[model samples]
Target: MFSKVLVANRGEIACRVIRTLHRMGITAVAIYSEADAGAKHVALADEALCVGPAAANKSYLNIEAVIEAASSTGAEAIHPGYGFLSENVEFARACTAAGITFIGPAEAALEIMGDKIRSKNHVAQAGVPLVEGISEPGLSDEQLISAGEKMTFPVLIKPSAGGGGKGMHVVERPEDLGETLATARRVAKASFGDDTLFIEQLIRSPRHIEVQVLADAQGNVIHLGERECSLQRRHQKVIEEAPSALLDEATRARIGQAACDTARSVDYLGAGTVEFLVSDEEPEKFYFMEMNTRLQVEHPVTEEVTGIDLVEQQIRIAAGQPLSLRQEDITLTGHSVEARIYAEDAEARFMPSAGTIIGLQEPTGEGIRVDSGMLPGLVIGTDYDPMLAKVIATGADRDQALSRLHQALGGTIIHGLTTNTAYLQQLVADEDVRRGQMDTTMIERKLPDLQFPTPQQHHAVAAGLLAAQLKGLHPETAGNQEEGPTGWQPDGWRHSGAQNPVFAVSWQPPGTTAEPQEFDVIVDGSSRLIPVGEGRYLLRSSATATEVHLTAGEGSRQTGTEIWISSGDFTGALSVLDQEAATHRQLAEIEAELTEALPEVTAPMPGTVVAVGVESGHEVNAGDVLVVIEAMKMEHRLAAPTAGTARINVALGDQVSLGQVLAAVEAEQAENTESKD
Candidate 1:
């Protein structure tokens, strides 16, 4: 085994790799950009180095810097975790040239499969079932159009490079083809630096299934079953599970063999995934999508179900050893499901949320696994992916696993930053998801009803109110309440007895533009309070206090109330903003102002503009890649649309402000464009 390994990546994946290395008694070296200096992965590594500035172009993507860091640290191998240099063929070759092992597939394999068109062709030649499309290279736009005509309307324009939905566009008709092509080309050039693209027939409502395979240098290979990754948003997976519920034993075996065939055809090494598009409309029909020649982000579900440490296996194989376990040794013990918890607001368009995490509660039980990068004090920054953690649950069967997942989500609590926690809870219990009838279009189909949180919102409001009340009674405020300028507190002197002080406070629930809920709180100056809102407030003083005295307000309801507290240590109540509002108060007010002021342009996520497609005064349509933001060695283009607008913003080479206005697009009408990246 290697004594030390350099992890050439950042965020949760880096932290995840280092954890496995530590368990295997190997020193882990972490590389970070300026923005990642204080990141979770950096603090977790045994050795750390700053490669360059915040921008990934000058840091994470800097091949020379990474190599030097590895050499200086005397690392015997470099583990390019997922994104960044994970799939970069040149980086793999560089490591080999430097006599350092790369813990992934060989550079030759990457060179062939990294290009989408070539990879598809290779798989097709191996007799794998491929979807109807052109996998050949060197096709002109006119030729592409001809191929599209053959495929008919609703064709998929995919970049013949990288994955993760980047540079992929879906055109429903001919009139949208040109713009989609231009956008795809620009995105392809930015993301992969290869403007090459291919056309495919769109598989409506397809379940994105993938087979996990591992191979050693000696050509010994085995398949570890399949993972269903149909629950997605913005082309990125949100939820994943192992032993796809939709596939039968025969179909599963066939898919597994096809995956092995594809791996052997490419001389694949280490752990990789062969993705397939399984149609929801047809149970037995599955088509080859592409092969990811590195560890997948949703690998935990596979690990949980198979009892395998994929990272440890990667290292063992890279050391020129065979896979530790044979196909027969692999067994699917139970059902497992994982949800990718992101720091984004699910109700408010899933906007990436950045803020300090005031409190955190991770679920722990018989079958729960939480792979996280966040703690109580960690601050989520916009310079990286908005993902906070991957919450996994396992059980003896599918229904049990789903039940456990729902419980885990409920037990898990996060404060400070907005999250998709409420949405996740709903998704697990959702009829389609629970029935295992999930597909990529599942979320979209249930979007209208799933767009808001009702019960969770009620609980959140109750928690917020409780938190506000708790803050009001804090020692600091309790000691100096009468001296405040607002004169909001009652005038009082020293009280000798245990007195319950009542105060009236009002708050508007989230998403409600008008009318704030008014409540009266009676504090006994102890640890708890009785809150009365639109319902009667009850106080429990004994174990059998069901019929305790109830104080009712006008229009009070018979339903009892639940509360939430903001403090991480506190249980049963939500955390409400404790600090009194200054001239401006309430989260809604702050959000409203931010929306009115901030521009619509997609901001950079710790990346550089590799290419600028437009200039001042250029009229651009929606979904146009105005500027490409490259980060962690990967490039992402910021596009326009959802409305069309003329450029009235700054020029290229300008160090743009965070959330600055790049251009203005006055929406001709409100419309939703599904994300391509």
Candidate 2:
């Protein structure tokens, strides 16, 4: 066994590998960027190294830096935990040249499986079933159109070199195929550095099932059942489960054997997952999609059910140890379900959310597990993937596992930043999910029907009360501040004759830009924060008692003292605004009625401007692309609001804050009038 291993990744997966290393008595070395100096993984490791700056390319994906860090730390092997450099074939070769073991598949496997088009061709030769399409490389656009004319109308256009739903598009009409191919080529070229194109038949209502396979250097291989990853949004998995409800024993054995064959075909070593697109109607028919040559983000569910440590297996394989367990020894004991928690707003098309985690609550009980790198004051910036953690649950059956997962999600709390916790809870209980009638399109299809909780008067009251307590009153205000400003105590003050303080506060629900509703909370002199440990508080009143979770944060706003609160399924921010701030916002009702056309183009979220389509004072149509901002590894193109002159305010490479005006459209009417004059 290797005495020391370096984790060339950050966040939750890095922490996960370090934990396994410590359990095995192996020293764990962690590498981090400047932004992650205080990260949880760094604190968990025996040694740490600073790779580079916050930018992923200069840091986590820096091959030379990672190799140097491993050498300096005296690590025998390096683990690339998903994302970043996990699937980089060049990084693996670098480690080998540096005499540091790469704890993943061999170079041959990486070369063959790294490219989707190549993997499909390789696996098909191994007798693995494949979806029908034009998967050959080096085909021109005109040739592809000519070839696609005879195939089905709706087809999938994807890059040959990447996964994770990036650079993949579905074309429904034959006429739209050429246009989509151009867009796909651009995206694929930008994301994967290879514009290699391929076509695949778009399987309708397919269930995504993948088999986890492990092999040693001696060519010994075994399968550990299949995981259902059909719950997805935009091709990224949101939830996963082990021992899929769709597969019977016969089909399970078949798919498992097919996965083993894929591993053998590559002369594979270490842990890998072979993904397949299974027909929802015909459970017996499954087609190979692609192979992931590293640990998957959804690997926890397989670990929970199989009672095996995948990381341990990876290390052992890399150390040239033979397979310790056979296929007969592997058994799926129980059902496990996992929900991915991301720093994103589910209500607003799941846009990435960023900020400091002021408070957190991870559920723990029978059959519940949490794999996370979340710590108080952890700054979730827009530099990398948005997934923060995962919540997994196991049970004797699928129903119980689903039920436990739902309960666990309900108890999960993250304040000071928006998350998909509430949405995950709702998804677990969704009818399609519960009945096992799910497809990859289920989440997007059912998103409109999922009812998220909105803030009410009680929520407002709880937040207001907490805000008042969090910001205590001054001694003078405690006595009588009849003439003083109300916000000296944050919109709360003791009346000259009254015994208690009154908090005139406003509550804003999560994921909204609307004005907060006004609420006056009268806190009795006796009303105080009870000693409730772990973020929960019960506010006692004459009428009723309500419990809310809260955290005092340096608010995003300039003037308000923001108190983040959570009660039941709803989370919101309570702002204590002085009279001037509140009245000014509410008084601007007429301005809200102005035309959205020729509107100010503001940054929807904080990000860096990657592209500027037009220079200042250029004429553009309503749909012309104005600027492109990249955040959380996704590019958002801002377009003109209406036909007008583009007045650009920001240049390329400029860092922008949310709501910062990037440009504005000067209406054509103004241009016409100026021309006439």
Candidate 3:
């Protein structure tokens, strides 16, 4: 085994690799950008090095800087963990030249399979089943149109140089082909620096299946069953599982052998995944999609079911070891499912959310595992992927695994930032998902019907009572005799009345536009507000009594006292208004003025404006695209809410903050009157 290995990545995958290296008795070295100075991966590594700035292009993708870091830290091998430079052939060759082993396939294999067009051709020649499409390179717009016509309607135009759903478009009509192709080419050039694209037949309702293959230097290759990755959004996988519920024993063997054949055709080495698009209607028929020439993000599901440490195998193979186990020796033990927990809002088209994690509680028990790089104080930024962690559950059967996954997600708490935790819970319990009847389009189809649990009245009342008690304990206003256990006044009664002090409070549920619920809570005595711990309280009322987990954060100047409350499965933020503070009245006046202002298009999140589709005096209709903002490597198009004349404020390439007005739209009465005259 190698003495030291450098992880050439960041976030959860880097931490995962470091953990396995430590188990193998190898010191792990970590590389980080400026944004990840205090990241979990950096702290977990035996040695750390700063590569470059926060941008991936300047840091993680800088091949020379990574190589220098590895060499300077005396790392014997470099493990490119699934992103950035992981699939770059040049990085592999550079590591080889510098006498450091690359823990992946050979550079030759990467070159052959890295290009979609080239890989399709190679696999087709080797008799692997392929989807009908045009793989010829350097096709012009006219040529692409002609090819699309030949393939019939509903064809997919994809950039041949990159993956992750970037620069990919689907056109269902011939009339829209030209514009779609132009957009695809432009995005492809910008994203991958290659305008080369190919047309493929769009398989309706296909199931994504991939076989994990490991090859040693001695030419021994074996497959580790398969994983179902059909649950996706915008071509990126959301949930994945091992020992696919769809595949039978016979079909599993066939697909496994086909994947191995594809790998052997190029003398592949280390860890690689062979992806395929299996028709949902015809499970026996499968078409090769592409081969990822490095470790996969969903490899843990396979690891859990097969009881094999894939990272350990990769290192062993990189050290010129032969295959430790043959194909017959490998076995799939149970069902395992993994849910990718991202810092994103599922209700808002999965828009990426960035903020500091105020409090975190991970689930732990039998059949549950969490692989994460996040800590309580970590800041999720927009410079990298929004995935915070992955929660995986294993069981003897699929039903049990699904149940455990649902429970695990409920027990997991990620506070202060918006996340997909509630959405994940709904997905697991979805009727079709629970029955193992799902396809690539199921999530998008069912997204509109999925509902998040609403916060109960008792929960809100608890928050209100807690907030009122906390407010009275303020040393600045209350008698400074040192607050009581419940953070109430020393006398435990307001001087205003002996009956008790009743205050109106409001609570806004997470991820909703509904009006904030209002209720009145009376703090009569210590029995109603009991302090359990430093940041926990029990609120008792006539209707109900509940335990509330409260965490006090820095007070927002606009919202006053901000407290995060978690009761049962519902979590929300409560802003307390004493109705007595002078500041509250001032805030009310400011809010009233803002609410009466002219209608304007504002940025929903912090991002950079990539495109502005309107200008001053330009007339736009409702639902027309007004501006495109890029955040966390994804593009979101903001549309005009109503028909009007647009007065643009933000230009292309300008940074915008949440709720910052980008444009104002007024009724186009002037234009209409002029036209009539």
Using TM-score as the measure, the top candidate is 2
lDDT assessment of candidate 3 = 0.83
Model 3 lDDT tens row, 73-131? 89999999986888888899999899999999998899889899999999999888899
How far residue 356's Cα lies from its native spot in candidate 1, in Å, is 2.4
- At residue 43, give the lDDT of candidate 2: 99
**Cα lDDT for residue 55, model 3?**
77
Per-residue lDDT tens digits of candidate 1, residues 1-677? 89999999987789899999999999999999987777888999999999999656688888999999999999999999886788989998899899999999998789888888888887777777888887679888877877677676778888887676665777999777876787678667755668899988877789999999999999988999999999987567888998899999898888888889889988899999999999887868889899999999889989999989999999999998887688889889899999989877666566566666665767899899988877767767655667788889999998899899988887677766567877888889898888898788778677677644332332333333343354454322443455344334532333342223443334333322456445444344333234443222332332321111111111111112223232221222222322233212455567777775423665533334556767655667767767765443334467775445555465554555445566666555556888888
At residue 369, candidate 1 shows an lDDT of: 91
Compute each candidate's TM-score over C-alphas: 0.79, 0.92, 0.91
lDDT by residue for model 2 over 1-677, one digit each (tens)?
Answer: 89999999999999999999999999999999999999999999999999999988899888999999999889999999987788889999999999999999888899999989889888887778888999888998888888999888689898888777666888999999887787678667656678899998788799999999999988798999999999998788999999899999999999999999998999989999999999999999999999999999999999999999999999988999898899999989889999999999888777889989999989999999999999998999998888999999999999999999998988888987899998998889888899999999888788888787776666655665565555564323343444445433344344334344554577654445676577765554334444377778875555667777878777533346677778888876677644444555555544665636448888877898978989999999998989988888677788998888999999988999988999998987643444543
Number of clashes in every candidate structure?
14, 0, 0
Least well predicted 10-residue stretch by lDDT in candidate 1: 547-556
Tell me, by lDDT, which candidate is best.
Answer: 2
